[model samples]
Target: MHHAMRQPLPKPTPANLRRFAETPVARKAINTIKDQIAGMRWRIQRRDGNAPAATSDVRIHILAANLDAPNPDDSFRSLTEQVIEDVLVGGWGAVEVQLTSDPQRPLLLWPVDGATIRIYAGWSGDAEEPRYAQVTPWGRHVDLRNDELVYVRLNPRSHTPFGLGRLEVAFETISWLLGAQDYAARLASNTVVQYALWLAEMPPASYDKVISWWQNEIEGTGKVPIIANLPAKPEVLRFGEGSDRDLRLEWQRFLIRIIANAFDLPPLLLGLEQDVNRSTAGPLLEEAFRTAVVPTARLYAEHITREILGRRLGWNDLEFVFEDLEIFDERAQAEIDEILLRNDVLLPDEVRLRRSLPALPGGWGGLTYTQRQMLIGGQRSATGDQ
Candidate 1:
């Protein structure tokens, strides 16, 4: 009975919790796969630029694939196990790994002295090949039964390419949503605030207040106030005479209100109110089409993720943390995915997929629950957590 006593799990932190909460964008597309990001803790270690890249006291490394490494199905698992057992665990070294297949340094790992392991295993349905797996610290977990699992090393610089790029590829539909030119355009009309409220699916009383305000002011003098700031050079203009700054401003506000209402109304099940006039509604519709609404879409995605992971998945063995982060980058690479940098996993409002990343070859970035299910069939209950 000689075994390393199981290491203590990393406790949740404000930082950690944020990491598990999937981004609005991530939430939308990740649905293609099972999701799991609540219970894990992540380590985002890096070298300070001021300090030298290499020093006796500071040796920074991230897990990624080395093209030359063994294939996961053939001999790499044993190779990694040997490294984990003979090299890492034996000497007590800090570890970080990237779990993916690649042509260079196919499997890159440095045995670390940490007490945890992070595994990454995600496969698009088309890629039925065995996943490449790597390990980091602590020990491995037998519970992770995804045959399509492998660990690849990810340097900070190569992050966007691997994670975001893959995310973009896998969630092509959702990705398209954010990239839509119309979705990214911006319009700010305080009057649109009213419509915004309505679109947000507010109660009829809320809409009534807006309607009342509109009727009270414009109903009398046929005048409305400027509700929001516009560019010094507004792209839109009023062709009719008497459309002064005052009138234009009113139009803009009213338009914004309408746009807001359009935004607020979603789920498409409850239905929406459509009795708006051209003078009041035209701008609203126009501005909406012009503005990229990606942010709003992102906001909605975040809310949905919160509900699905925190509420539905919470009851199951799944837990997720939403982490906000700067994009990770490295020079020489066109995009960040294959770079030799760290911050890749430090997602901008990312949800760490596991209770924590794993140290085994399979725990590179870890798989979302769907990936887990595809690889291995069990999932946490959806009715257990509050």
Candidate 2:
């Protein structure tokens, strides 16, 4: 069923955005984020109000396995990388959930190219209704309901059904960067000169001979040895004024910073390290993770929890999260954890979970250090009373 078409305004299409993403600085910035996100671990936790409760549900077990290996062709990391790349370039990521007959792994997730999926401008209030349609290889449209697919949009806006891509924001900058690089390449390849040869008051035959001789030997091959080179002495006429920076390096670096800003990254991540030092590097990296990586990972986690766990499997108690996603480095996080533990702000098990370590034996991790000390003192007091 089709409602009023959104009639997209003049903007960069997914193709154009992807083309720009392939450029040097953009690709580096995107890949850096993608690699970090993909490498992080995903966990399915039962939402027990901050308490870590182990789950015994078979469906949840199957889900964990399925997420580990989404399908035969893609692992969790590979699928995650593709989804993130699609979101960065096109502002959308799509995954079709396929159900299998096998009980061990009852579901598989296949990553769909966002370009093939079109979101309905008008969404029906019913959750079961189709809000998106996929254009097939045979040019047919297949409608997908909310639960059957996981569709994530980055930087969604009210004006349009589609999300706003980072590359789209930097489209003109990328175009300028590409143009400048192309011009510089042509200048280098063509061996551009600062001056031109002007044959002053020379015979037509001599001019033709000079032209022929230049084209044949000296044009692209550089200045050659000429004996006496006379008959009007072909004066050199300078064409343009010279500049200090000819390769447009400063312009390209400025454009790279713009691109980094569009992606909410620090310019240092994109190889603009002129302003960064050892003291500032950690802070810059932390800020980048806070601004760019954390939000992106949380967005994916939310979609997965809502669509896969809530809508499809009816597992309201479960939540999906990326492990160790804090912006703090290990040392900082360890210090924070130590402080929290010292102050009895968190239980040992909770800190262990954050560190991705297994719980201690005999459920000893559930109590705070002070609580354990008090319990041990009470036990000795009971022994004395006996």
Candidate 3:
């Protein structure tokens, strides 16, 4: 007789396993932070492009190919965008690379839930190596090697591999914001100008009758006007003034600015109206990208290059470089490049390469025309022009 086959159990839901740090307030703050950072452009380059080997030069192409298709479904750009967003929101994030059976092309990156993976560091006395222990939703434990994972952390605490996110530090501010919003909503909905009925000589038993009559007559329809019979005229009393509402709004904006400061973001970038003209706005925006976006992008690039590219592929010379943030005039760079070319400080081919143009034919492109003329003269000829 054949034995009955055992059915595999389903994996546990990630939401059930761990609580996320993203509250409604935190999510709003994180989204604002991400919107500013996601627009930055970046690329990977070789450390030494002038190296003598043919295959070594083509390594950039090979690396780009691997990054172009990180997994079956996601591209490197999309994966990086998601990873950055996750890390900013949660403090630390990771992606697991499942190596193929072939030795040539080993890594196949796949997005994994960071909450499921538990990191273990080897103690000083223990001979064991540091490893990642991933517990599946179905309660299966799988150990992973360091090279098999690409991890990114921001502002990590001492003695721990995991990072401490901005959400942890800004928790109190976010809660206050939430509470302020709730109070504003309640004020808007519940506080209204109410009419009080004042009677000259009404009995206690007649109070309920008068209230019921008033409700039926005044609250029934807006089109029809009510003429109530009372001993004295009704008095109008307002619950809150317009100035109080304005103060609440101002306080909320002040709190938002505080939150922006924690993330190192300028209130102007987040669409907060300030007393700034074009002159001041330009400098503030430049400072924002320099202090906030550039540093964060560098952190991401350095970690990925060292952990994934250096260790996994053994391509230590390769690195990820974010393109310079151009908040100033583009024509200024062109003018600077022209000055350098005229002085023979940079070769024509080198200048062309920087502008993404093809090199000129033969070795003539190596020297500028000024240098060529100077060499033809046989002696150093100077007439004000370099």
For residues 29-127, could you state the per-residue lDDT of candidate 3 as single tens digits?
Answer: 566556555555555566664322322356665655776687878877667767766666556667886657644455687777666678887624332
Q: Write the per-residue lDDT of candidate 1 for residues 1-386, one digit (tens) a residue.
A: 00111323333332322232244433322221111121112221222311111111121121112211334442323333332221111111122333345423323433332223233345343434433333433445422222222222212134332211122122322223323322223212222221222224444545555555546664445676343222221122333342244234443334333323322222111122345555755554334323322222233234323432233223222222222111211232224433322334332112221112323344423333345455543334433442
Candidate 2 on 16-125: residue-level lDDT in tens?
78777887888988887888999997677777735446433566567788899989999999999999998888788889987788878877899999878987777776
Q: Write the number of the candidate with greater lDDT, choosing between 1 and 2.
A: 2
Q: What is the lDDT of candidate 1?
A: 0.29
Clashing pairs in 3: 12-137
Among all candidates shown, the one with the greatest TM-score: 2
Candidate 2, clashing residue pairs?
none
TM-score of each: 0.17, 0.89, 0.75
TM-score of 2: 0.89
lDDT: worst 10-residue window of model 3? 1-10
Candidate 2 accuracy as lDDT: 0.79
